[model samples]
Target: MTTQVQSGGMVNTTLMGGGALLVVGLGLALANLMTGGHASFNSGSDGVTWGLPVVNYVFFALTSTGLTLVASLALTFGNKAFYPIAKRCVFLSLITLVAGFASLALELGHPFRMLFAVPLNFQVNSPLNWMGVFYAVFLVLGVLKFMKLHASDWDSDTSKQVGLAALVTECLAGGMLGMAFGAMAMRPMWYGTLVPLYFLLTAACTGGAFALLMTYLTYGSESAMPEKVRALVQGPLPAALAAVLGFTILVMGYQTVIGLWSNADGMQVWDHIVSTPWFWIEAGALVAAFYLLVSRSSLMVAAMLIILGLFINRYEFVIGGQLVPLFKGTWVAGMISYTPSITEWMLTVMAFGIVLAGWAFGEKAFNLSDAPKE
Candidate 1:
């Protein structure tokens, strides 16, 4: 949902709206648990195990990592122009990571068991295992960095050092998660070096777009942006967004051509994607968002579209990747049909609800509207 702001005030209506969303989301999540969430997976014979919760997890997690990187531009790299926006970015990064973790907890069969097992047992060979480790590190570092940022000695050297550590850890965590998918030889659509590279690029782009949208929504479109925030938005952010979007388009095109030509099972997964309406929606949104981005016209619209496109991109990739029948015995018509159950939808809603509630909390607790001068 697009944020609403008026006359330098974030609308109370919007806050109420977010609250409403949270209530509905949480209610559905509770209902889902009562109904036995993942038990429904056995009803389908398809190999597609990951569903809406995973999609929600990927979307929030990628944005969180990207938002952290944006914060580091000012916090770690000492970019004065980016400083005004750093606090908001850092705060959002933390909230989104928390939201992602919540999704992970709900997705797991035994949530508490995962909490103990992930740290106690180390799997050196598994990217997913490494992903969990790094995710935990990122969360710890992020909280420390956020605290240091809001502290009285925020500008001190120690704060900067913590910021740097947070930045490095966040990048590593994001890369490892990308590698988790890229390393999946069983999933042809996500395999190889390209997927990881594409993941990072999209993360950066999503972060930039999200920051811009949040800043605009925070300050209200009618109000003037602070000079520093405006500079950062106009300067490096646009460049990063354009470069990443362009490169991703190129990568996608290459992947598509190779998939069609190679005729290999992994590459041929593109054929299934081509037939899906979701794929077209994802592609169209990306192209339209890119056009809006480069033109610098209707930026709020562009940022919203970009974020939507990224969300859809993650959704399609997660779902479409598993659509091709990996096991012929369980598949119907060479593909598994998956329409996320009501429970799955509820879990996704809950993930977003966490984000909305987190923002509301930050607005009050952290004074999210005001960026203090150094």
Candidate 2:
């Protein structure tokens, strides 16, 4: 009883703290809008037009998609191990996607206009347009699926069907998100078919990591976890994570090697990228994360490391692509520099604040444990 009370108190404290951060972030975002819009951001006409907020958007968006995909293993594929926490994954997916939208809202000059423009002005050739549509569908399907899961006590054919639909939509959305960058022929660094596959791979990694982290947090320790959940986390989950991390490492390594060997103007940015301390930090984090997973040292630590590495990886990908000025030698001299402003950082805080609060609320309101069999 004492332990339960302590846990409740901790959750309440987290909720309040997250709420405060959200309020502060929103205040800063409003201040930014009033004070000349994009001027507060570090982006300029010549370089890095898509800055930190964009990175945050991509990070949260892909994480949400990944969560949906991972949840499908239980809901759609009938993976018994995942059944215990599948609902929580769905909940997190919805919250993270909303947080992503919030970041995007702050990034855009007039976010409200998009609500009207996107639906009214259909651009068939636009990957972004299709991406938006798919995500919107995903959000709707996810909500319906969650509702059905709760209504049917977490086991029903209807919920499974919806989960499958959500999974498909999430895949389409994630792929289109990558295509949004890959299709830009002008951005030579980003112009490739691999980008979409890379996005999906990293998405799976993040999703799995998040699931593991949440499981540990919810249960407190392996000993505290139910036998079924413990078995899943100890055996299958870690094995899957290790495999994905290995693939990610291979892809990233090859990307670096190929970039160095190429003489393309945009590929030259890899030379600069490899020299940066951040790049090494990103690589080190992933390698360390992989080691932790493989050696079965600490799943929580590995998850944290993977999340951090992925954030840095996304940051480098977005910023590095724009570093090499499009009109090199003619207008720009060398690589462009970018540092996210205070406003952008605060907005990131806001997104995390939302996640923290949402998770706490979900824990408080819902029974996240394995559903009782009918």
Candidate 3:
């Protein structure tokens, strides 16, 4: 009854799991509202905690940004190698960007202020304010691109130019968050030259992961992609996975080093994260995820584990980054211990739900599983 795409390499069930995960993530939100985050965040105990919700913001941004990068490689650059997946990449990037925004909104204590304040008040120093500007510009350009897709006269040179311009703006806007991290002179943890590149590399992996899952769900195992897609994905996916893994180690290794010598905040964070047993759990999951790339039997298991690793990475980053004595002098090793509060946790769960629901809605809106036939 339905149309066919690829033929027989992927397992149909993996796609099913992807759908189920969407539900589970969403379902957790409802459960959280009913039962509560179970983890309390007393402001007295944790300080005015921002929690992992912000990390979700970063992750969502990574996902969207990565998709945008890959899409650009395919479309604007005229890379025939990437064309098969270009459309899906663009649409998926859009989906992830929206989800990231949703998560950020949920995490905010003053969401209404952010929404209304920027346009009215306009503070440029605030990264959030700049992001608002970025988002508005990107959204307008994106609409222009979307319009080209539906327009009968899209083949006209003017329309193509508009689409191309939109894609470029999207990438720049999408990269804003990543650049923000790298450009922070005050935060030693975030200031590394490689941090922005790290963001881009991980973004590609996340985007590829999303595409793979989408393809699996729609076509189920037998994707008879053009030779270009075949080569690009086969080489690209593993490369991304490896780069991300290496970047995680580099970041963590520096922390471990800092903790041993200096009483720096990042070092202090290193102490907590490394000292914990869950550190191994996180590390092990990442290793296993990368290892699965070479395996034929259980890519799904590995993918699941990698996703778990990603979550732990985010969790550690969120919790560990704040645990450091931010305001206190270097002599004070620990001024904060962070545990997510019920509100923070609930918001995270809700954010996950929103992402899943949004993705599901996204699938119906665009043929996110299909790329342009090269």
Candidate 4:
């Protein structure tokens, strides 16, 4: 059973679980997509749809950037402590990046055009354009790096040099994603320039935690992040990451508070985020993450808290961004905002399923469980 688990059994399980989830999720998402577009979801009201779907995409994309960098750095930088956990992390990034794009495609009216014709059709300064270009560059660099790593016998030194440059580019692209949204004055809640900085920090925290979790689960105990690996990731990494997350939360909350005190609409949305159940939920996860990190618990406990904390942060970023309505010169509460329709939920589930399926299958099929001997 253990041999099979290390070989084909895991793949079979993932395919069964993730594959089924994907089919149902995508089916529902598609149905929702067909109905929502070509007409206002709000019945002639001109308001941007803000809710779970878009937030989910952002969470996935941002995480992709962080995960990619974390993985690539370990592989290429000769960081032995970090190396056992780097493999498949980049593959995971690529998978989730596709998921992000998939969610965004469902949300847009002309999703297909955004890939090609939209650039020629639209202007340069649009935030979407910046995001498009950044995503484009990351996508291209990702492919190039993948090819170089997998194509032929690139020696360790060469691979490291090339990987460093490519991953660095990916990081810049990832930071732009946050900057693009946060800089949008149209949404004052998102207008802080530090948004990029905030997002980048969270990405690292979550990405590290994710890598740690996968290391334990995918490989046996031998594959579990060793003391050295944990020291490297959860220690200095989290210590620094926590500072940054704390900073962003402080800055973000401060901005929200100031915005509310000064403006009517700001206050309404601020009230919603601060006073609602969601607010407490987000805060609780974040606080717990800190609790684990700061406390002298088992490394497993600390890593789990950090990972869950980051996940909760992702959820809040998605939902909170949309919770505050930027309408009527004053925000309104009591209106339950967008929930992922069943289809929307399914598509997301499917995307997740596909990733798990791929990861599990790859581990069995291709020896993804083994770290790069490089």
Candidate 5:
């Protein structure tokens, strides 16, 4: 017996539940769009432009990039220890990127127009344009890579080549996503070389965390996993997470210190940021997660904490950067306060629902555990 790993009942239930969430969320989102348009969102015309939707976009986008980078360890670098999970990582990357794009489509005023407008009116000097182009390429490459992997049953030289290309594309796309914020000269808080580097770092952390999380969810426990796969999970996975978390902490600490010391125009936003309980909570969660990983306490707990903290971190980074009004004493007086509307919340639910349902379906349909032959 091959230790029948398919938990059919559980997988089916998850699929149905996720599908229900997807329907409910999409119905609400469409209703909102039909009624009030983008005005339904909490984002104002003057103060806060990018709101929760953008945060959601960044969260999923970076996470997808992270998964691609993680998968590259095996596909591109030929790391045998990582082979078992590489297929899952690539599949999740595709699903999550689709989710991110869906959220962005909901956010944009005219989503379909972008399909043609971007290429027709390409602006080389614009970081946003480059970000869009890179991501578009990345999405296409991701699809091709997944197709190759699936067709070859996760073993092919051609798939490896595509994986290598995907790794490079993801780096460019991830960096561009950061540059989309860092390149904004008007937003002092977001402008810096650190933003892109931080994005890449967090991408790794989030990607690794998600991969670990899904592995645990699928296997239920270490004993359920194949002997060799379990060894890889216990040894290499947590070790990689630990190393990335260490670097992430250092970068976050330095970013905070720099924010505190800088007397730039929008730097005052940090004052408000440091005062909030969420800020400390975000930092605390990462610290706890790091400790858990190093202490060999629980990889599951660490993964959950890292995901939670990174979500909050993304929320803060997106909203906090815009809190300080560009023009003082105008219609916007002090720090702009924004609360995500129910519509925005529903969109987020929709994104999660899509990911949950897709992942569950993939698990039930595909042999995600089939390790590549040496």
Candidate 6:
């Protein structure tokens, strides 16, 4: 009998879906906490302690960095096309940033220590320690920027200054994240100063792709998108996306070739990775994203593929880094295997759920529409 959907029905639907994800996520988290931290998980050995949590953390954190930087650039440049989505981008950044921290929390031996100890205890030399500090600063700046944009006019000089501050802090946070792992020379795959720079570029690509997708979803129709919005998505986004993809492909290809050629214990992990089904999935999604962007096909499809590819990349980066057991010089009998515990899967769902809830709430509360009414 109730065939007609009410106004804001879609938002309600998203809210409900997000709520379900949150419940499942929280329930599993509580269960894991009570049971004492992923005891059921098979992390292979001491060589592979980190798993899905690290992957999820890196994936969300990188995306957060991307969104914060993109939104700030939009504000700083005063590009009318990019202006409309700045607030949304900032809000999404905050959401993903918090989610990233949550994922990391789950991975920790004592998750509660993150709240106070992270701030009070200073490991000045550790990149990971510095990363936590940078993340906190980035979070504060994001919240400040979001509040400014939400409560005041977008054109205010104060907002621009806040945006700039947020941008600088985001770069610091993102760079520290990459360096946290890259500084580990023992893990040859992750080593190098170039890693931070690579993260910055990829963050741009991720942010651009994500913003484009959100634009398509929120605007409803092509006519709904302002001329400037169209230019932002169809112009800069595609070009940037293509270029970033090209660079990523080149780097990854070089890594793969060198890994195979070396056939050392560390590099030998690539042999196992290349043979896995996920490798093709990651490659296919990346190729599809590139093709869609270069061809100027469906921006939505391209965005989806890009996000998927990036997520898979995070998984491979984190997991593959530890697959080959580093037992002095002797090779292990078999490859280290890891399958995410149920709790890990639930937390991953919870992370995306938080993103959905934030997006829906932002749309509902801020009237995040492109209709030119506000």
TM-score of each: 0.91, 0.94, 0.75, 0.79, 0.95, 0.90
Highest-lDDT candidate: 5
lDDT of 5 at 251: 84
lDDT scores of the candidates, listed in order: 0.73, 0.83, 0.58, 0.60, 0.84, 0.75
Task: For model 4, give the 10-residue run with minimal summed lDDT.
Answer: 1-10
- For candidate 6, write residues 269-357 as lDDT tens digits: 88887898887887898888888888878878888888887887788878888877777345554567677878788778888788777
Q: Per-residue alpha-carbon lDDT of model 3 for 210-329, expressed as tens digits?
A: 655554443433246444545555665545555665666566566557656776445556656777887898788767766765543344455556656666766665555556545766
Count of clashing residue pairs in every prediction: 0, 0, 10, 4, 0, 1
| Candidate 4 structure quality by residue, lDDT tens digits, 1-374 | 00112542335666678777777877766666676653322212223355545666777777777777677656666555555445557666776677777877766767776667875777766666776676666776665555554443234566666567657765776677777777777766566777787777777766665565555455434344345444555555556446655664565567556756867443355665666576666566666756655553444455566655555555555455555555633344433355445655665686676666666665655444344443
**Model 2 misplaced regions, further than 4 Å:** 1-10, 328-330, 372-374
Q: Is candidate 3 or candidate 4 better by TM-score?
A: 4
Model 6 global lDDT (CA atoms, 0 to 1): 0.75
Q: Spell out the clash pairs found in candidate 2.
A: none
lDDT of 1 by residue, 166-263 (tens): 88777777788889888888777787876666777788877877787777766665237655556666666766677778887777777677767776
Candidate with best TM-score: 5
The root-mean-square deviation over C-alpha atoms between each candidate and the true structure, in angstroms, is 3.5, 2.7, 5.0, 4.5, 2.0, 4.3
Off by over 4 Å in 6: 1-10, 221-227, 328-332, 369-374
Query: lDDT of model 2 at residue 5?
Result: 12
N/CA/C clash count, model 1: 0
